[model samples]
Target: MDTILIVNPKGGSGKTTLVTNLAGYLARQGEMVNLIDTDKQKSSIAWLKHRSPHLPTIFSTHTHNFANFSVKPSWSIIDTPAGLNEEILKKLLKKVDLVIVPIQPSFFDFQATQSFLEILNTKKPIRKGQTSVALVGMRVHPRTITAQQLEDFLKRQGFPIFTYIHDAQIYLQMASKGFTLFDLSPAKAKTHIEQWQPITEWIQNAHKI
Candidate 1:
Protein backbone atom coordinates (compact mmCIF):
# COMPACT_ATOMS: atom_id res chain seq x y z
CA MET A 1 0.00 0.00 0.00
CA ASP A 2 1.10 3.56 -0.60
CA THR A 3 0.92 5.87 2.44
CA ILE A 4 0.62 9.67 2.18
CA LEU A 5 0.87 12.09 5.06
CA ILE A 6 -0.76 15.52 4.65
CA VAL A 7 0.99 17.84 7.08
CA ASN A 8 1.39 21.51 8.00
CA PRO A 9 2.36 22.51 11.51
CA LYS A 10 -0.09 25.38 11.27
CA GLY A 11 -3.84 24.89 11.40
CA GLY A 12 -6.30 25.97 8.70
CA SER A 13 -3.70 25.16 6.10
CA GLY A 14 -6.32 22.89 4.43
CA LYS A 15 -4.66 19.64 5.53
CA THR A 16 -8.02 18.02 6.12
CA THR A 17 -9.31 19.31 2.82
CA LEU A 18 -6.45 17.60 0.97
CA VAL A 19 -6.88 14.41 2.95
CA THR A 20 -10.60 14.00 2.29
CA ASN A 21 -10.45 14.98 -1.36
CA LEU A 22 -7.45 12.78 -2.18
CA ALA A 23 -8.99 9.81 -0.42
CA GLY A 24 -12.23 10.39 -2.28
CA TYR A 25 -10.42 10.56 -5.60
CA LEU A 26 -8.59 7.26 -5.10
CA ALA A 27 -11.72 5.48 -3.92
CA ARG A 28 -13.80 6.73 -6.85
CA GLN A 29 -11.17 5.24 -9.15
CA GLY A 30 -11.84 1.78 -7.67
CA GLU A 31 -8.86 1.78 -5.29
CA MET A 32 -9.29 0.60 -1.71
CA VAL A 33 -8.32 3.60 0.44
CA ASN A 34 -8.02 4.42 4.11
CA LEU A 35 -8.37 7.79 5.84
CA ILE A 36 -6.60 8.17 9.16
CA ASP A 37 -7.42 11.25 11.23
CA THR A 38 -4.72 12.17 13.72
CA ASP A 39 -6.11 15.63 14.32
CA LYS A 40 -7.77 16.36 17.63
CA GLN A 41 -10.67 17.96 15.78
CA LYS A 42 -11.30 14.67 14.01
CA SER A 43 -12.36 16.60 10.95
CA SER A 44 -11.40 13.81 8.55
CA ILE A 45 -13.24 11.26 10.68
CA ALA A 46 -16.32 13.45 10.60
CA TRP A 47 -16.02 13.89 6.84
CA LEU A 48 -16.05 10.14 6.33
CA LYS A 49 -19.04 9.78 8.61
CA HIS A 50 -20.86 12.40 6.60
CA ARG A 51 -19.83 10.80 3.31
CA SER A 52 -22.71 9.54 1.24
CA PRO A 53 -23.27 5.82 0.75
CA HIS A 54 -23.44 6.31 -3.01
CA LEU A 55 -19.89 7.63 -3.15
CA PRO A 56 -16.83 5.40 -2.98
CA THR A 57 -16.09 4.37 0.58
CA ILE A 58 -13.16 5.72 2.61
CA PHE A 59 -12.36 3.30 5.43
CA SER A 60 -11.53 5.19 8.61
CA THR A 61 -8.99 3.94 11.14
CA HIS A 62 -8.46 4.88 14.76
CA THR A 63 -5.23 6.35 16.14
CA HIS A 64 -4.45 3.28 18.23
CA ASN A 65 -4.45 1.00 15.23
CA PHE A 66 -2.80 3.45 12.84
CA ALA A 67 0.51 1.60 12.57
CA ASN A 68 -1.12 -1.74 11.84
CA PHE A 69 1.32 -4.03 10.07
CA SER A 70 -1.27 -6.22 8.40
CA VAL A 71 -4.22 -4.16 7.15
CA LYS A 72 -3.39 -2.48 3.85
CA PRO A 73 -5.13 -0.49 1.14
CA SER A 74 -4.21 0.91 -2.23
CA TRP A 75 -3.75 4.30 -0.56
CA SER A 76 -3.64 5.58 3.01
CA ILE A 77 -4.13 9.30 3.54
CA ILE A 78 -3.22 10.74 6.95
CA ASP A 79 -4.39 14.11 8.29
CA THR A 80 -1.89 15.47 10.81
CA PRO A 81 -2.42 18.03 13.57
CA ALA A 82 -1.07 21.55 13.75
CA GLY A 83 2.14 22.42 15.67
CA LEU A 84 3.67 19.05 14.90
CA ASN A 85 7.23 18.81 16.24
CA GLU A 86 10.34 17.37 14.68
CA GLU A 87 10.24 14.19 16.76
CA ILE A 88 6.66 13.39 15.83
CA LEU A 89 7.41 14.25 12.23
CA LYS A 90 10.30 11.82 12.11
CA LYS A 91 8.10 9.12 13.60
CA LEU A 92 5.38 9.74 11.06
CA LEU A 93 7.84 9.80 8.18
CA LYS A 94 9.06 6.37 9.11
CA LYS A 95 5.73 4.94 8.03
CA VAL A 96 4.71 7.18 5.14
CA ASP A 97 5.61 6.73 1.48
CA LEU A 98 5.12 10.38 0.64
CA VAL A 99 4.59 13.76 2.32
CA ILE A 100 2.35 16.66 1.24
CA VAL A 101 2.55 20.07 2.87
CA PRO A 102 -0.17 22.64 2.16
CA ILE A 103 0.25 26.38 2.33
CA GLN A 104 -2.07 29.39 2.28
CA PRO A 105 -1.21 32.94 1.25
CA SER A 106 -0.38 34.43 4.63
CA PHE A 107 2.58 35.09 6.90
CA PHE A 108 1.51 32.62 9.54
CA ASP A 109 1.26 29.85 7.01
CA PHE A 110 4.48 30.80 5.26
CA GLN A 111 6.53 31.04 8.45
CA ALA A 112 5.47 27.67 9.78
CA THR A 113 5.67 25.97 6.42
CA GLN A 114 9.22 27.15 5.82
CA SER A 115 10.27 25.92 9.22
CA PHE A 116 8.60 22.59 8.58
CA LEU A 117 10.62 22.21 5.41
CA GLU A 118 13.77 22.92 7.36
CA ILE A 119 12.89 20.00 9.57
CA LEU A 120 12.34 17.78 6.59
CA ASN A 121 15.61 18.92 5.07
CA THR A 122 17.46 17.66 8.11
CA LYS A 123 16.15 14.14 7.70
CA LYS A 124 18.57 11.71 6.06
CA PRO A 125 15.89 10.25 3.86
CA ILE A 126 14.72 13.64 2.65
CA ARG A 127 18.26 14.68 1.85
CA LYS A 128 18.73 11.41 -0.01
CA GLY A 129 15.43 11.78 -1.87
CA GLN A 130 14.29 8.47 -0.45
CA THR A 131 11.02 10.10 0.59
CA SER A 132 8.79 11.58 -2.09
CA VAL A 133 7.41 14.95 -1.03
CA ALA A 134 5.42 17.76 -2.62
CA LEU A 135 4.06 21.19 -1.75
CA VAL A 136 0.46 22.34 -2.38
CA GLY A 137 -0.99 25.83 -2.51
CA MET A 138 -4.48 25.98 -1.06
CA ARG A 139 -7.21 28.58 -1.54
CA VAL A 140 -4.94 30.77 -3.61
CA HIS A 141 -5.84 33.09 -6.46
CA PRO A 142 -3.61 32.72 -9.48
CA ARG A 143 -3.45 36.44 -10.28
CA THR A 144 -2.83 37.84 -6.82
CA ILE A 145 0.46 39.21 -5.42
CA THR A 146 0.10 36.71 -2.60
CA ALA A 147 0.14 33.94 -5.14
CA GLN A 148 3.39 35.21 -6.61
CA GLN A 149 4.96 35.38 -3.19
CA LEU A 150 3.82 31.87 -2.41
CA GLU A 151 5.31 30.66 -5.63
CA ASP A 152 8.63 32.32 -4.85
CA PHE A 153 8.58 30.85 -1.37
CA LEU A 154 7.96 27.35 -2.62
CA LYS A 155 10.55 27.71 -5.35
CA ARG A 156 13.13 28.77 -2.79
CA GLN A 157 12.50 25.60 -0.84
CA GLY A 158 13.37 23.56 -3.94
CA PHE A 159 10.08 21.65 -3.85
CA PRO A 160 7.56 21.33 -6.62
CA ILE A 161 4.07 22.88 -6.26
CA PHE A 162 2.11 19.95 -7.60
CA THR A 163 -1.13 21.85 -8.13
CA TYR A 164 -3.23 24.60 -6.63
CA ILE A 165 -6.84 24.75 -5.44
CA HIS A 166 -8.45 28.10 -5.85
CA ASP A 167 -10.45 29.75 -3.10
CA ALA A 168 -13.98 28.57 -3.89
CA GLN A 169 -17.12 27.86 -1.95
CA ILE A 170 -17.67 24.57 -3.74
CA TYR A 171 -15.17 22.82 -1.47
CA LEU A 172 -17.02 23.87 1.65
CA GLN A 173 -20.35 23.13 0.07
CA MET A 174 -19.23 19.65 -0.88
CA ALA A 175 -17.90 19.03 2.61
CA SER A 176 -21.26 19.86 4.11
CA LYS A 177 -23.05 17.71 1.56
CA GLY A 178 -20.84 14.68 2.25
CA PHE A 179 -19.38 14.90 -1.23
CA THR A 180 -16.20 15.90 -3.06
CA LEU A 181 -15.40 17.14 -6.51
CA PHE A 182 -14.97 13.52 -7.56
CA ASP A 183 -18.50 12.76 -6.42
CA LEU A 184 -19.93 15.30 -8.83
CA SER A 185 -20.38 14.75 -12.52
CA PRO A 186 -17.29 15.64 -14.53
CA ALA A 187 -19.39 17.97 -16.66
CA LYS A 188 -20.04 20.03 -13.53
CA ALA A 189 -16.73 19.71 -11.66
CA LYS A 190 -14.33 19.49 -14.54
CA THR A 191 -12.37 22.56 -13.52
CA HIS A 192 -11.87 21.58 -9.90
CA ILE A 193 -11.15 17.98 -10.81
CA GLU A 194 -8.58 19.07 -13.33
CA GLN A 195 -6.64 20.92 -10.62
CA TRP A 196 -6.15 17.61 -8.80
CA GLN A 197 -4.93 15.64 -11.78
CA PRO A 198 -1.23 16.38 -11.29
CA ILE A 199 -1.23 15.54 -7.61
CA THR A 200 -3.07 12.28 -8.08
CA GLU A 201 -0.92 11.31 -11.02
CA TRP A 202 2.24 12.09 -9.09
CA ILE A 203 1.17 9.81 -6.26
CA GLN A 204 0.32 7.01 -8.66
CA ASN A 205 3.75 7.23 -10.27
CA ALA A 206 5.79 7.65 -7.06
CA HIS A 207 5.82 3.91 -6.45
CA LYS A 208 7.85 3.38 -9.59
CA ILE A 209 10.62 5.71 -8.46
Candidate 2:
Protein backbone atom coordinates (compact mmCIF):
# COMPACT_ATOMS: atom_id res chain seq x y z
CA MET A 1 0.00 0.00 0.00
CA ASP A 2 1.08 3.58 -0.61
CA THR A 3 1.58 5.73 2.50
CA ILE A 4 1.44 9.54 2.75
CA LEU A 5 2.40 11.19 6.02
CA ILE A 6 1.12 14.72 6.75
CA VAL A 7 3.71 16.14 9.15
CA ASN A 8 4.41 19.53 10.67
CA PRO A 9 6.15 20.34 13.95
CA LYS A 10 3.90 23.32 14.52
CA GLY A 11 0.20 23.50 15.24
CA GLY A 12 -2.31 25.47 13.08
CA SER A 13 -0.56 24.33 9.96
CA GLY A 14 -3.70 22.73 8.56
CA LYS A 15 -2.23 19.20 8.72
CA THR A 16 -5.45 17.51 9.86
CA THR A 17 -7.54 19.44 7.36
CA LEU A 18 -5.28 18.44 4.49
CA VAL A 19 -5.19 14.74 5.45
CA THR A 20 -8.93 14.30 5.91
CA ASN A 21 -9.89 16.15 2.75
CA LEU A 22 -7.24 14.41 0.67
CA ALA A 23 -8.32 11.02 1.95
CA GLY A 24 -11.94 11.79 1.29
CA TYR A 25 -11.19 12.92 -2.25
CA LEU A 26 -9.20 9.78 -3.00
CA ALA A 27 -11.90 7.56 -1.54
CA ARG A 28 -14.50 9.28 -3.71
CA GLN A 29 -12.32 8.53 -6.72
CA GLY A 30 -12.71 4.78 -5.97
CA GLU A 31 -9.34 4.23 -4.32
CA MET A 32 -9.35 2.26 -1.06
CA VAL A 33 -8.17 4.86 1.49
CA ASN A 34 -7.34 4.53 5.16
CA LEU A 35 -6.58 7.51 7.43
CA ILE A 36 -4.40 7.02 10.51
CA ASP A 37 -4.48 9.77 13.10
CA THR A 38 -1.20 9.84 15.06
CA ASP A 39 -1.91 13.22 16.61
CA LYS A 40 -2.64 12.89 20.36
CA GLN A 41 -5.17 15.67 19.85
CA LYS A 42 -7.27 13.19 17.84
CA SER A 43 -8.71 16.00 15.72
CA SER A 44 -8.94 13.76 12.70
CA ILE A 45 -10.46 10.97 14.79
CA ALA A 46 -13.23 13.24 15.98
CA TRP A 47 -13.85 14.36 12.42
CA LEU A 48 -13.92 10.75 11.22
CA LYS A 49 -16.47 9.65 13.78
CA HIS A 50 -18.74 12.54 12.89
CA ARG A 51 -18.23 12.15 9.15
CA SER A 52 -20.53 10.21 6.90
CA PRO A 53 -20.41 6.42 7.32
CA HIS A 54 -19.47 6.03 3.67
CA LEU A 55 -16.10 7.66 4.31
CA PRO A 56 -13.30 5.34 5.51
CA THR A 57 -11.10 6.32 8.48
CA ILE A 58 -9.20 4.43 11.16
CA PHE A 59 -8.00 6.03 14.36
CA SER A 60 -4.57 4.99 15.63
CA THR A 61 -2.29 6.62 18.19
CA HIS A 62 0.60 4.26 17.52
CA THR A 63 2.26 3.11 14.28
CA HIS A 64 5.27 1.10 15.49
CA ASN A 65 3.94 -2.07 13.75
CA PHE A 66 1.26 -0.58 11.50
CA ALA A 67 2.25 -2.73 8.54
CA ASN A 68 1.61 -5.83 10.64
CA PHE A 69 -1.98 -4.73 10.98
CA SER A 70 -4.44 -6.26 8.50
CA VAL A 71 -4.79 -3.17 6.32
CA LYS A 72 -4.99 -3.75 2.58
CA PRO A 73 -6.15 -0.34 1.53
CA SER A 74 -4.74 1.29 -1.60
CA TRP A 75 -3.57 4.38 0.28
CA SER A 76 -2.71 5.11 3.91
CA ILE A 77 -2.68 8.76 5.04
CA ILE A 78 -0.98 9.27 8.40
CA ASP A 79 -1.58 12.55 10.31
CA THR A 80 1.28 13.21 12.73
CA PRO A 81 1.58 15.39 15.82
CA ALA A 82 2.78 19.00 16.12
CA GLY A 83 5.82 18.37 18.33
CA LEU A 84 8.88 16.80 16.73
CA ASN A 85 9.57 13.53 18.54
CA GLU A 86 12.56 11.80 16.99
CA GLU A 87 11.65 8.20 17.77
CA ILE A 88 8.04 8.42 16.67
CA LEU A 89 8.83 10.54 13.61
CA LYS A 90 11.66 8.25 12.57
CA LYS A 91 9.49 5.15 12.83
CA LEU A 92 6.76 6.69 10.71
CA LEU A 93 9.22 7.93 8.07
CA LYS A 94 10.81 4.49 7.89
CA LYS A 95 7.47 3.06 6.78
CA VAL A 96 5.77 5.70 4.63
CA ASP A 97 6.11 6.39 0.89
CA LEU A 98 5.90 10.19 1.05
CA VAL A 99 6.05 12.94 3.66
CA ILE A 100 4.08 16.17 3.15
CA VAL A 101 4.67 19.17 5.40
CA PRO A 102 1.84 21.68 5.43
CA ILE A 103 2.63 25.21 6.56
CA GLN A 104 1.05 28.61 6.59
CA PRO A 105 2.66 31.53 4.73
CA SER A 106 4.64 32.83 7.71
CA PHE A 107 8.17 32.96 9.03
CA PHE A 108 7.48 30.95 12.20
CA ASP A 109 5.98 27.98 10.36
CA PHE A 110 8.80 28.02 7.83
CA GLN A 111 11.38 27.88 10.63
CA ALA A 112 9.40 25.09 12.31
CA THR A 113 9.68 22.97 9.15
CA GLN A 114 13.48 23.06 9.35
CA SER A 115 13.35 20.79 12.40
CA PHE A 116 11.53 18.13 10.40
CA LEU A 117 14.00 18.53 7.57
CA GLU A 118 16.94 18.11 9.95
CA ILE A 119 15.52 14.85 11.27
CA LEU A 120 14.90 13.49 7.79
CA ASN A 121 18.41 14.44 6.71
CA THR A 122 19.85 12.21 9.46
CA LYS A 123 18.13 9.03 8.24
CA LYS A 124 20.11 6.44 6.26
CA PRO A 125 20.54 6.74 2.52
CA ILE A 126 18.32 3.72 1.92
CA ARG A 127 15.44 5.61 3.49
CA LYS A 128 15.71 8.19 0.71
CA GLY A 129 14.13 5.88 -1.85
CA GLN A 130 10.99 5.32 0.21
CA THR A 131 10.68 8.91 1.34
CA SER A 132 10.05 12.25 -0.38
CA VAL A 133 9.10 15.58 1.23
CA ALA A 134 6.96 18.42 -0.11
CA LEU A 135 5.62 21.64 1.32
CA VAL A 136 1.97 22.63 1.06
CA GLY A 137 1.16 26.30 1.51
CA MET A 138 -1.98 26.58 3.56
CA ARG A 139 -4.28 29.52 4.34
CA VAL A 140 -2.51 31.74 1.88
CA HIS A 141 -3.97 34.98 0.63
CA PRO A 142 -3.62 34.90 -3.12
CA ARG A 143 -3.41 38.65 -3.58
CA THR A 144 -0.79 39.26 -0.90
CA ILE A 145 2.86 39.86 -1.75
CA THR A 146 4.00 37.94 1.31
CA ALA A 147 2.29 34.79 0.07
CA GLN A 148 4.03 34.95 -3.29
CA GLN A 149 7.34 35.79 -1.63
CA LEU A 150 7.05 32.81 0.74
CA GLU A 151 6.32 30.40 -2.11
CA ASP A 152 9.22 31.77 -4.15
CA PHE A 153 11.56 31.55 -1.17
CA LEU A 154 10.74 27.89 -0.54
CA LYS A 155 11.19 27.04 -4.22
CA ARG A 156 14.49 28.89 -4.38
CA GLN A 157 15.65 27.02 -1.28
CA GLY A 158 15.11 23.75 -3.19
CA PHE A 159 11.97 22.79 -1.31
CA PRO A 160 9.41 20.84 -3.32
CA ILE A 161 6.17 22.74 -2.89
CA PHE A 162 3.22 21.04 -4.55
CA THR A 163 0.45 23.64 -4.17
CA TYR A 164 -1.07 26.47 -2.19
CA ILE A 165 -4.40 26.37 -0.44
CA HIS A 166 -5.81 29.86 -0.33
CA ASP A 167 -7.40 31.30 2.78
CA ALA A 168 -11.08 30.54 2.19
CA GLN A 169 -14.08 30.70 4.45
CA ILE A 170 -15.60 27.80 2.55
CA TYR A 171 -12.92 25.43 3.84
CA LEU A 172 -13.54 26.44 7.41
CA GLN A 173 -17.32 26.25 7.02
CA MET A 174 -17.26 22.80 5.46
CA ALA A 175 -14.64 21.48 7.87
CA SER A 176 -16.60 22.72 10.85
CA LYS A 177 -19.52 20.60 9.68
CA GLY A 178 -17.30 17.55 9.14
CA PHE A 179 -17.67 17.86 5.37
CA THR A 180 -14.92 17.77 2.80
CA LEU A 181 -14.64 19.84 -0.37
CA PHE A 182 -15.90 16.79 -2.21
CA ASP A 183 -19.15 17.07 -0.26
CA LEU A 184 -19.63 20.80 -0.76
CA SER A 185 -21.43 22.61 -3.58
CA PRO A 186 -19.19 22.48 -6.62
CA ALA A 187 -19.55 26.13 -7.50
CA LYS A 188 -18.87 27.29 -3.98
CA ALA A 189 -15.83 25.08 -3.50
CA LYS A 190 -14.00 25.61 -6.77
CA THR A 191 -10.87 27.15 -5.23
CA HIS A 192 -10.09 24.34 -2.80
CA ILE A 193 -10.96 21.73 -5.39
CA GLU A 194 -8.50 23.24 -7.83
CA GLN A 195 -5.74 23.43 -5.21
CA TRP A 196 -6.19 19.76 -4.31
CA GLN A 197 -5.67 18.46 -7.85
CA PRO A 198 -1.88 18.33 -7.80
CA ILE A 199 -1.79 16.49 -4.45
CA THR A 200 -4.19 13.83 -5.73
CA GLU A 201 -2.18 13.41 -8.90
CA TRP A 202 1.04 12.98 -6.93
CA ILE A 203 -0.45 10.30 -4.70
CA GLN A 204 -1.90 8.44 -7.66
CA ASN A 205 1.46 8.39 -9.42
CA ALA A 206 3.66 7.55 -6.38
CA HIS A 207 6.06 4.71 -7.14
CA LYS A 208 6.52 1.70 -4.89
CA ILE A 209 9.95 1.31 -3.32
Candidate 3:
Protein backbone atom coordinates (compact mmCIF):
# COMPACT_ATOMS: atom_id res chain seq x y z
CA MET A 1 0.00 0.00 0.00
CA ASP A 2 1.13 3.55 -0.69
CA THR A 3 1.23 6.02 2.19
CA ILE A 4 0.96 9.79 1.74
CA LEU A 5 1.68 12.11 4.67
CA ILE A 6 0.25 15.66 4.68
CA VAL A 7 2.14 17.62 7.31
CA ASN A 8 3.22 21.16 8.21
CA PRO A 9 3.68 22.46 11.72
CA LYS A 10 1.50 25.39 10.93
CA GLY A 11 -2.18 25.73 11.69
CA GLY A 12 -4.70 26.78 9.04
CA SER A 13 -2.29 25.67 6.35
CA GLY A 14 -4.92 23.48 4.63
CA LYS A 15 -3.67 20.08 5.76
CA THR A 16 -7.14 18.59 6.33
CA THR A 17 -8.38 20.10 3.11
CA LEU A 18 -5.61 18.40 1.16
CA VAL A 19 -6.21 15.09 2.92
CA THR A 20 -9.99 14.95 2.35
CA ASN A 21 -9.95 16.15 -1.23
CA LEU A 22 -7.18 13.76 -2.19
CA ALA A 23 -9.03 10.95 -0.43
CA GLY A 24 -12.19 11.83 -2.33
CA TYR A 25 -10.32 11.86 -5.61
CA LEU A 26 -8.68 8.51 -5.03
CA ALA A 27 -11.88 6.88 -3.81
CA ARG A 28 -13.81 8.17 -6.80
CA GLN A 29 -11.23 6.58 -9.05
CA GLY A 30 -12.13 3.19 -7.45
CA GLU A 31 -8.93 2.97 -5.47
CA MET A 32 -9.18 1.55 -1.95
CA VAL A 33 -8.43 4.75 -0.01
CA ASN A 34 -8.09 5.03 3.77
CA LEU A 35 -7.66 8.35 5.56
CA ILE A 36 -6.02 8.41 8.96
CA ASP A 37 -6.37 11.51 11.10
CA THR A 38 -3.57 11.94 13.62
CA ASP A 39 -4.35 15.52 14.52
CA LYS A 40 -5.95 16.16 17.87
CA GLN A 41 -8.45 18.43 16.17
CA LYS A 42 -10.00 15.44 14.42
CA SER A 43 -10.93 17.59 11.46
CA SER A 44 -10.78 14.67 9.05
CA ILE A 45 -13.05 12.60 11.26
CA ALA A 46 -15.63 15.36 11.34
CA TRP A 47 -15.52 15.56 7.58
CA LEU A 48 -15.96 11.80 7.33
CA LYS A 49 -19.02 12.01 9.54
CA HIS A 50 -20.48 14.53 7.14
CA ARG A 51 -19.59 12.48 4.05
CA SER A 52 -22.60 11.37 2.04
CA PRO A 53 -23.25 7.66 1.87
CA HIS A 54 -24.18 8.00 -1.80
CA LEU A 55 -20.62 8.98 -2.64
CA PRO A 56 -17.78 6.55 -3.26
CA THR A 57 -16.50 4.76 -0.16
CA ILE A 58 -13.38 5.85 1.72
CA PHE A 59 -12.43 3.93 4.82
CA SER A 60 -11.13 6.14 7.65
CA THR A 61 -9.65 6.00 11.13
CA HIS A 62 -8.76 8.49 13.89
CA THR A 63 -5.88 7.75 16.19
CA HIS A 64 -3.91 10.05 18.44
CA ASN A 65 -1.37 7.51 19.63
CA PHE A 66 -0.61 6.22 16.14
CA ALA A 67 -0.95 2.59 17.15
CA ASN A 68 -3.04 -0.35 16.00
CA PHE A 69 -2.24 0.40 12.37
CA SER A 70 -3.26 -2.80 10.67
CA VAL A 71 -5.61 -1.92 7.83
CA LYS A 72 -4.05 -1.91 4.39
CA PRO A 73 -5.37 -0.30 1.23
CA SER A 74 -4.22 1.10 -2.10
CA TRP A 75 -3.65 4.49 -0.48
CA SER A 76 -3.17 5.66 3.09
CA ILE A 77 -3.53 9.42 3.61
CA ILE A 78 -2.30 10.50 7.04
CA ASP A 79 -3.01 14.01 8.37
CA THR A 80 -0.61 15.18 11.05
CA PRO A 81 -0.95 17.84 13.73
CA ALA A 82 0.20 21.42 13.55
CA GLY A 83 3.43 22.13 15.45
CA LEU A 84 4.47 18.49 15.27
CA ASN A 85 7.84 17.61 16.81
CA GLU A 86 10.72 16.19 14.88
CA GLU A 87 10.82 12.94 16.85
CA ILE A 88 7.26 12.12 15.82
CA LEU A 89 7.94 13.28 12.29
CA LYS A 90 10.89 10.93 12.12
CA LYS A 91 8.64 8.04 13.03
CA LEU A 92 6.04 9.02 10.46
CA LEU A 93 8.60 9.44 7.70
CA LYS A 94 9.90 5.94 8.19
CA LYS A 95 6.65 4.56 6.77
CA VAL A 96 5.64 7.24 4.31
CA ASP A 97 5.99 6.93 0.54
CA LEU A 98 5.45 10.62 -0.08
CA VAL A 99 5.30 13.68 2.14
CA ILE A 100 3.19 16.67 1.08
CA VAL A 101 3.55 19.98 2.89
CA PRO A 102 0.72 22.40 2.16
CA ILE A 103 1.21 26.11 2.81
CA GLN A 104 -0.57 29.32 2.01
CA PRO A 105 1.02 32.18 0.05
CA SER A 106 1.56 34.48 3.00
CA PHE A 107 4.33 35.56 5.34
CA PHE A 108 2.33 34.34 8.32
CA ASP A 109 3.00 30.68 7.54
CA PHE A 110 6.40 30.94 5.93
CA GLN A 111 8.55 30.64 9.04
CA ALA A 112 6.90 27.45 10.21
CA THR A 113 7.08 25.91 6.76
CA GLN A 114 10.77 26.73 6.43
CA SER A 115 11.58 25.27 9.83
CA PHE A 116 9.52 22.14 9.13
CA LEU A 117 11.19 21.63 5.77
CA GLU A 118 14.58 21.91 7.40
CA ILE A 119 13.66 19.19 9.89
CA LEU A 120 12.18 17.02 7.11
CA ASN A 121 15.37 17.27 5.07
CA THR A 122 17.35 16.02 8.02
CA LYS A 123 15.23 12.90 8.46
CA LYS A 124 17.01 9.73 7.36
CA PRO A 125 14.24 8.47 5.05
CA ILE A 126 13.97 11.75 3.15
CA ARG A 127 17.75 12.19 2.92
CA LYS A 128 18.20 8.61 1.71
CA GLY A 129 15.32 8.84 -0.79
CA GLN A 130 13.45 6.11 1.08
CA THR A 131 10.62 8.65 0.83
CA SER A 132 9.89 11.51 -1.55
CA VAL A 133 8.69 14.97 -0.50
CA ALA A 134 6.98 17.80 -2.35
CA LEU A 135 5.43 21.18 -1.65
CA VAL A 136 1.95 22.41 -2.58
CA GLY A 137 0.82 26.02 -2.24
CA MET A 138 -2.82 26.25 -1.24
CA ARG A 139 -5.31 29.08 -1.67
CA VAL A 140 -3.02 31.05 -3.93
CA HIS A 141 -3.75 33.66 -6.54
CA PRO A 142 -1.34 33.21 -9.41
CA ARG A 143 0.36 36.28 -10.91
CA THR A 144 -0.04 38.27 -7.72
CA ILE A 145 2.84 39.68 -5.65
CA THR A 146 2.16 37.18 -2.90
CA ALA A 147 2.32 34.34 -5.33
CA GLN A 148 5.53 35.61 -6.80
CA GLN A 149 7.05 35.94 -3.36
CA LEU A 150 6.02 32.39 -2.56
CA GLU A 151 7.55 31.09 -5.77
CA ASP A 152 10.78 32.94 -5.05
CA PHE A 153 10.95 31.60 -1.51
CA LEU A 154 10.45 28.03 -2.66
CA LYS A 155 12.99 28.45 -5.43
CA ARG A 156 15.61 29.58 -2.93
CA GLN A 157 14.86 26.57 -0.74
CA GLY A 158 15.27 24.16 -3.66
CA PHE A 159 11.97 22.37 -3.05
CA PRO A 160 9.78 21.37 -5.96
CA ILE A 161 6.36 23.03 -5.91
CA PHE A 162 4.19 20.47 -7.61
CA THR A 163 1.04 22.62 -7.85
CA TYR A 164 -0.91 25.59 -6.53
CA ILE A 165 -4.56 25.46 -5.54
CA HIS A 166 -6.36 28.60 -6.59
CA ASP A 167 -7.95 30.69 -3.86
CA ALA A 168 -11.58 29.62 -4.20
CA GLN A 169 -14.50 29.63 -1.79
CA ILE A 170 -15.80 26.49 -3.46
CA TYR A 171 -13.15 24.47 -1.61
CA LEU A 172 -14.40 25.76 1.74
CA GLN A 173 -17.97 25.09 0.69
CA MET A 174 -17.09 21.57 -0.38
CA ALA A 175 -15.44 20.81 2.97
CA SER A 176 -18.55 21.82 4.89
CA LYS A 177 -20.48 19.39 2.66
CA GLY A 178 -18.00 16.51 3.05
CA PHE A 179 -17.12 16.40 -0.64
CA THR A 180 -14.30 17.44 -2.93
CA LEU A 181 -14.29 18.88 -6.42
CA PHE A 182 -13.82 15.33 -7.65
CA ASP A 183 -17.22 14.33 -6.24
CA LEU A 184 -19.01 16.88 -8.40
CA SER A 185 -19.89 16.17 -12.02
CA PRO A 186 -16.79 16.42 -14.16
CA ALA A 187 -18.18 19.44 -15.94
CA LYS A 188 -18.87 21.28 -12.69
CA ALA A 189 -15.51 20.54 -11.09
CA LYS A 190 -13.43 20.46 -14.24
CA THR A 191 -11.34 23.47 -13.40
CA HIS A 192 -10.85 22.74 -9.72
CA ILE A 193 -9.97 19.11 -10.24
CA GLU A 194 -7.69 20.06 -13.07
CA GLN A 195 -5.67 22.12 -10.60
CA TRP A 196 -5.06 18.92 -8.71
CA GLN A 197 -3.96 16.91 -11.74
CA PRO A 198 -0.25 17.28 -10.99
CA ILE A 199 -0.78 16.00 -7.45
CA THR A 200 -2.82 13.04 -8.64
CA GLU A 201 -0.27 12.20 -11.28
CA TRP A 202 2.55 12.35 -8.76
CA ILE A 203 0.67 10.14 -6.34
CA GLN A 204 -0.26 7.65 -9.04
CA ASN A 205 3.30 7.45 -10.29
CA ALA A 206 4.66 7.23 -6.75
CA HIS A 207 2.74 3.97 -6.39
CA LYS A 208 5.62 2.26 -8.17
CA ILE A 209 7.88 3.12 -5.25
Global lDDT scores for all candidate models: 0.85, 0.75, 0.88
The residue-by-residue lDDT of candidate 2 on 89-137, one tens digit each, is 7666667778888888888877777666666667763245547777788
The 10 consecutive residues of candidate 2 with the worst lDDT sum are: 58-67
Q: What value of lDDT does candidate 3 attain over all alpha carbons?
A: 0.88
Mind giving the per-residue lDDT tens digits that candidate 3 earns over 1-209? 89999999998899999999999989998999999999988999899889999999989988876644644898999998888888788778777789999989889788888888888888888888888888999999989999998888777666688898999988888888899888898888998888899999999988865
A best-first ranking of the candidates according to their TM-score comes to 3, 1, 2
* Candidate of highest TM-score: 3
TM-score of each: 0.94, 0.87, 0.96
TM-score of 1: 0.94
Which candidate ranks first by lDDT, i.e. highest? 3
Candidate number with the higher TM-score (1 or 3): 3
